[model samples]
Target: MTIDSVRGAPEPELVQLLTPEGERVEHPDYPLDVTAEELRALYRDLVVVRRIDLEAVALTRQGELGIWASLLGQEAAQIGSGRALGEHDMVFPTYREHGVAWCRQVEPLNLLGLFRGVNHGGWDPAEHGFHLYTIVIGSQTLHATGYAMGMQRDGVLGTDRAGATIAYFGDGATSQGDVNEAFVFASVFNAPIVFFCQNNQWAISEPLERQTRIPLYKRAQGYGFPGVRVDGNDVLACLAVTRKALKDAREGQGPTLVEAFTYRMGAHTTTDDPTRYRLKAEEESWKLKDPIERVKAYLVRNQLADTSFLDEVDAEAKQVATALRKACLDLPDPRPLAMFEHVYAEPHPLMTEEQERFAAYLASFEEASA
Candidate 1:
């Protein structure tokens, strides 16, 4: 994957295609080799992701969900890496990666339940090959590293079929100790894990400058792995770079550090206010790089779609939001006792006592005989 270096530098050019206005450009070395169908599929992925993001935010406003992390601008970074993943490739994601969960076929509503304070995790990670969204910053990186080491022990690396892991963390997480340690372990052991850092340029109120002085990709050099930046807003670039990284890892080429340079177009969460820390001019700047608009531009420029198609895509995005709204409002409240069903394989005395006490409390509320 590290084919050529930048002029007088050790790293290659940060690969990018598809300008903010939707012009399809090409990388000198990492030319996109996907078909038109694949390109359109990327567009579809972005549409649905944005729809889910909007809906989740609305649910939080309606008080149906406890919290929501909106990935409004980082759609391309998620979809590109997500679509590039094989079915068997395990994904370790930090919370707010709703787009990645969507790419893995996790039911959109499953996400709401977690935010609704109904359950610890809405979807089983094993079923989707996506670990439960880790709340602690950058902790999942170590989990991915350990798992990748296990994959090596299992002798799955270098096999064409399956054996790649991806750890999804935020720009802020890059500053965490575990993320750095993960890189160290992965490099020494030659673990087949892809460290995907989606640098959305904001950690709550702090800017990217607060997180790093140099481009994030440059950090990979100290760990002895290839690190490269990609235009995270460019869907094609995300897929091309991440796919190559995973492929190289699987082929025993070792780990990769992919820093997706992107922006957080929305607030950190429904509870935070960007206006307090960021400027309107800054938001306007990222708006020019809207992930959805670029794909729409591509469709129009390539004659793949017209006004009618654009209208249809809009309708679809709206329909998705409406459906999510209805579903979240009507979602059944989980049985109080259901929470105790999967806590442990072997019986835990403390869990059993808590379950019984909670069940009795629920029964008391069910009917008060007069």
Candidate 2:
């Protein structure tokens, strides 16, 4: 069914705890008790994350990396939801979740390895409770649902210390078959997972209009679960909504769908030219709603941080970016033979034959030179 078919007369209101003007607001059901230091820390996180993205983009342009999928405007959505997780919680991420990876403490160099073509994935899932970036669109949703089912079977739900799984996808992924099937499975089994869809208003060249005429969250109602739309640019709102969803899942309340409504301030990837499909006016409009700027404004307005503190964060962010560039440049290229090494857990006759053939081909070139 089309999104317009399922949508109500009016789109559901977004859950917002902070306005674009940096004003603090309150929600009746979702309350946040953040200290001044914590607020400052969150602002730091946003700044560093954006710096990381900027450096990566520059690297791509300079031919140091193959390509980059920038999380330029969606930093709040990723960092906010990422920080809400418990130590044992698991996350399945889309390719652009650099901010979330940072919150999970995954090394920055590891992320660069993927774009640098040095490795398929750079970090262990178990080590950081973060899955490898999934480039196949909505595939991670199914993986997350299956994982949550395993958690339920293991009696890991309905406890104070219980953990939940979060599946991260894009607005475009909601149209995929895998995502819909995941919704069905999670709903039927009541899996303790959160489907976090970062609806950044564009599915590559396609706008939100191309995906659905209705708000994405409303689709969850038909699947026997509750869904809420949150202001993805508002870090506090994202954190609050995600925290509540995780708590409910841990308590055996089943799955939740969180549609984070935000905008992608950059092209789909380094290879894309957004000037073709989108407008200059549109880009300028979103600049006013910038995620990082709002947090910086709030910190300054509330006297939670000063020029010295903000400057310190800026300095720290620069160091991180510099270090990332060095690490990326220092990474050694993988040997050609390395491709066949990790294809299977156990060796197979066909693989052995292929490896031998490849080795003989390499030796032939050496022999000819001799």
Candidate 3:
């Protein structure tokens, strides 16, 4: 398939609950039942998440952040799967899982602080059931697998209190040894984890064709587990598939690989330029499949949400974006010595010496200024 043809057709195996033109379709394998209220909530989530991402990208351009990984077009994939998680379910995320972070109720400013180089992800992971974002590619899958194994040992599997873990990674990560290793471990242990890969077509500057010879979901079969590809742009399909996968996992059905086939309409990150690699026409084609637009269209067409509600959502999104910007600006810079903290579980002489020396250095500057 050519670059422009990437979003042309959905494969026969692709599960899509809502079409791009605002039409709803049914999939017998992955049935979804959503109330009007739930639909409105999902629409709100899509808008607010996109707004957060837009604000972050603006902040990066304004030099408030060191850099940012924008989740421009993949909002549905994150929100859908994120909302699908049970209250007790755990998530191991990559750096770009901002939408998932939002769904987890993580402070947007906290995320900005990480990019702002203030403190190492200020929120407590145990409190949120969301692990710290992993910068190293595909390593979180291993961590999620091990955590799921621990859950199994804890004897929660197949119980009412059972919980599953979901590991979020990008398509590029599929090539990493860590990811493949994770697949092997999860399968062998029958770990209750969902390997959620958001295949956004472009892995940095390289295209999807360069990443794999077959659909990414097919790789799961080789690992002795089930794999399914879903329309990443369809929020309903993502929710249904993820919900079922998580439920099956809790029941000791082993791991499942869910490949959300989607597109990234923006640069890989604020630092990189997509124009250098992909064509503008390719991005334009994917615009027709915009995750948020489809949901809006469906809401409008079905009258589940009137214009007033749609307007209200837009206003709320703006409010969220404005608050995020203010919070980002108000974030305090960490003290020079604060870096010495959290280096290890226990204090070390080397750290103490370095801290003292750094303090002395700062004192010297003050002394000179005086």
Poorly placed runs, candidate 3 (over 4 Å): 2-12
Cα misplacement distance, residue 362 of candidate 3 (Å): 2.4
lDDT of each: 0.86, 0.93, 0.93
Residue range 105-203, candidate 3, lDDT tens digits: 999889999999998998988889899989999999999999999999999998888999999999999999999999999999999999999999888
Clashing residue pairs for model 2: none
RMSD of each: 3.9, 2.0, 2.4
Per TM-score, the best of the predicted structures is 2
The lowest-lDDT stretch of 10 consecutive residues in candidate 3 is: 3-12
Question: Over all chains combined, what TM-score does candidate 1 have?
Answer: 0.91
Which digits, one per residue and each the tens of the lDDT, describe model 1 over residues 149-193?
A: 888788877665667899999889889999999999999999999
Model 2: how far residue 241 lies from native, Å:
0.2
Measured against the true structure, the TM-scores of the candidates, in listed sequence, are 0.91, 0.97, 0.96
Please give the TM-score that candidate 3 achieves against the real structure.
Answer: 0.96
| TM-score, model 2 to reference | 0.97
